[model samples]
Target: MDGDYVIGGVFSIHYYMHTVKHNYTTMPEPLSCTGSIDSRELRFSRTMVFAIEQINNSTELLPGIKLGYEIYDSCASVSVAVHVAFQLSGGLDPVFNTGDKCSQSGMVMAVVGESGSTPSISMLRVIGPFNIPQVSHFATCACLSDKQHYPSFFRTIPSDQFQADALAKLVKHFGWTWIGAVQSDSDYGNNGMASFLHAARKEGICVEYSESFSRTHPRSRIQRVADVIRRSTAKVVVAFTSTGDMRILLEELSRKPSPPRQWIGSESWVTDPDMLRFSFLAGAIGFGIEKSVIPGLRDFLLDLSPSKVADSPLLTMFWEEAFNCRLVKSFQ
Candidate 1:
């Protein structure tokens, strides 16, 4: 195990179920840890683990060295992500001391994760001092591209800056000069929307209104934004938000007696199957990361066993989803 390297990962496996009444004061219940399961995000986590196993088994990669990993669910909360980042950086205590170095051998060499940019930004600040490398699989906030501020950050996906430019260009090509904008209230949505707005302004596109809301925001706030969208004269609505945020907004929009307008999506929800359920967004279009097939990923997922299920809490959740049964003894 001397040659082993541990990679840290952060993912928003679970989301908060209850409304966030007090954004700063109220602490969510512990049971909120296991909210609605996002199977697609779970698949992303599984793919990462599968890739690590494949690398360990290959003679061409790492040769005699073994790669191990520790994955944490961020729950799509910055606070949760900060705690996990500290643990990954060997700062288990509440206080972070910059003087302390990660104990050499057991220190995480790198981190791959954090599906959203908000959590990634929060984790990056904590892990940056340790000089640990963080490579994100899904984070796309343009702010993360600043090497001067976040020197240790990298990503597998393109930056939101590029996506912003592309989106602006697409709108221009369609001759849509006026539009409405909606964004999630996190770094990913905030920064990405900022970039898009800047680009759109340069393209002479006038936004009728730009509204922002968080996933944990009260239903009334979400409804207010939906009301704005319903009343806006802009025919095109550019939605820069996560699938979770969009889910809430869509629910509110579905309640309204308004007609469907042209919807422009961000990479976050364009490909999400959940969004497909909204027939109102039938003509929605957005940029997506290039799709690629993983050779044995399907078989690996299909070949899950009880032993494998025992190794991961998330896998148990997956099993429950796949087989439509509860594993708890009480349910049994």
Candidate 2:
């Protein structure tokens, strides 16, 4: 009511004020009306699976859209990431003022966090129409089979079988006649330890001592692991644990000089950043995916992408969103 109101041919400020007051007491809050868009970050893993799909679709225009969906690997490792943001306000008139909106939300990535110990018995268990990406490496030693909820699962990390075999190799490399293994109490540890024991027996490797520590043992599990290492006559020890956890365990194990001139870990300790974090881990070796080894794949992706060209702005976005940061590829 900018000083202009009329009632019965007379200026009516009172009438306008009454109307405003009525509105002040009648309307709903503003947060309800503003909730429109919902976004999710689907993990496509670092590779531009989305870009590949786009290219495949574009090529279709040439009478040679021939491959349909077959030309490209539709293997997209999709996991849902959900985040919500909103604003809310309290007002006497039930009206939204200039910054009255309130919102809150969370995001979750569908990527599997550590479950990879289960054995995927066969290949091609299903021929579903939806494309599934192969998980060559898994982040955790948790057995995937126990979940029972997801049958079509794969991991990027080697299984307990692989780690067991590798641990034996490492022990042999050190020329250690006796070895010790400390594994977590969870499925990851149990399975990993069992595998190591089996492999050592098969390879004629003497496992002088083996111990298990509960991942949730309330106490310093790392200290327990260290205790096993000390009591054993083994000159080499195998530790199966997460990178961050392993660092702590190593620090504890290093507290006092002991036998086993070398400490070997599974692929869990192999990331470049993790290796560089502690100088003491300089000589640590583990099975890890060397992206450089697949420079060809990176090169091919770059060549096909006008955006990912040398010094291109898209290159930063691509790498940032893919490596470490997680791939949330939305053209927007």
Candidate 3:
């Protein structure tokens, strides 16, 4: 999406990256990321494109100026995210000495992503120094609210502190004085769970257990968490996990018969439609962002074709998965 001004988008469209084994003998090959595509994150990227198109078409907004975008997949890696931030900030481009007095600037006027808090933090370290404004849609780590550190950072989602307080209040209201806690082992989950624990203590709540895990952790680690969940005497479980980690844990817990317990979720995974497949998650409660109906947005999203997405490998993959067919390129 090219225009007079470009907005850079950083999204974790892929849930994981291939583990690279380096022999330390030669330069490692380019990083290869292999993982299941995250359809929700894909939608967010398309929505960025859609909104840019709408703004470009509008006669009143920005008047004659055209808005463009450059979207990149972070592949859920902090290193990759930092690399992308540098790219967006023009830090990776080679400088050529042209006989001009004017200074060079990056192609992107601003950035609009890095969906998770840890990745956002990594990106901020790269772009924040350059004074490039970055806004996140889902990164809710409470530490990001420090203006003294992330001066050019902003977000559409509320900080985790508020959500933690709400979750603690919800538990106290339900008389669940004792509960088990699980969190993703990252900035988002770790910081969020810390806030929730602090709030819970103030409300006279006690946690029976607190465990953390990442999606990339070994199966045995995830199983251990599930085993703890199964053995805990607390009837209510508070989970501050991302969708990926939650899915892994649910898969482990569903392997055999297990006692049913009330589940409390964070906004990161609470409203995910994919979690519905786990029957044990019935009656789970959590907070979510308010939903809004955007006029004509549904039609815009549906207006797609093989030809339209031919240039984008990501879109082509998504199309093939959606239609259950392989797309071949014709030389003619």
Candidate 4:
């Protein structure tokens, strides 16, 4: 999409990256991220496009100015995010010199995402120095709220510090003195779990075990965490993890015989509608962000088709999986 000014978007449209182990012999292969598309995050990207179109059609908003976008898939990787941030924030330097520092440059007026807190932080380190504003929809780490560290960073969701306190209180209310803890090994989970642990100590709660994992963790690592949960005596488990990491852990747990225990989750995984597929998690509990209805966003998302999305391989892959059909490409 093209316009007078561009709004850069970063989303975890894919859940995992197929990590390439380099031998450092010749040239390193291109980075490849492989995973099923996240429909919810995909909707977020589409909503950005839809909103821009609406603003372009309006006479009151921005008047004669038109806005465009250059949305990138983070694939939930901090390294990939940093790469894209450079692409969006780069190119501000004048190609030719006019003996003047002033010039019309910069790829985007502002950036609209980087859903995960870790990736957001990586992106901010790159673009924040340039004073580019980055508004996140899901990055909720309490560390990001620091003005000195993240001067140009902002988020729509409440900080995990508040959620951590609330979760600790919830456990105390139930008198679950002995519990197991789990978290993603990223900025969001580490910071959130640290807060929860501090609060839990004040409440005189004792944890039996604390484990961490990520979506990119090896199968053996995921199995080890699941085994810890299975063998633990604690009847309650508090999980401060992202949706992607939680899904990977849960999928591994579901494959083997496991004990029944109470599951407490963070807002990151708790609010995901896709988690409903795990019937064992029927009693899971967690907090959620406030919800609101958008007038025509649903229609715009539902109106997608193969023909319309053919040029976009990411969208085409999603459409194929969703409709359970393959699309044939015609060659000239």
Q: How many clashes in each structure?
A: 0, 26, 0, 0
lDDT per residue, candidate 3, 165-276, as tens digits? Answer: 9999999999999999999999999999999999999999999999999998899899999999999899999999998889889999999747989999999899888899
lDDT of model number 3: 0.89
Question: Best by lDDT, which number?
Answer: 4
How many Å off is the CA of 217 in candidate 1? Answer: 1.6
Candidates in order have lDDT scores of 0.85, 0.42, 0.89, 0.90
Error of 1 at 33 (Å): 1.9
Q: Please give the lDDT score at residue 83 for candidate 4.
A: 87
lDDT of 1 at 245: 94
Candidate 3 TM-score, C-alpha based: 0.95
lDDT of 1 by residue, 126-241 (tens): 99988999999899998899999999999989999999999999999999999999999998899999999999999999999999998688888988999999888998999999
Candidate ranking under lDDT, highest first, comes to 4, 3, 1, 2
Model 3: colliding residue pairs: none
Better model by lDDT: candidate 3 vs candidate 4: 4
Model 1 regions lying over 4 Å from their true place: 1-3, 17-32, 91-102, 328-332
Query: TM-score of model 1 relative to the true fold?
Result: 0.88
Q: Pick the candidate with the highest TM-score.
A: 3
Q: Kindly report which residue stretches of model 2 are placed more than 4 angstroms away from their true locations once superposed.
A: 1-136, 139-150, 156-158, 214-216, 254-260, 290-332
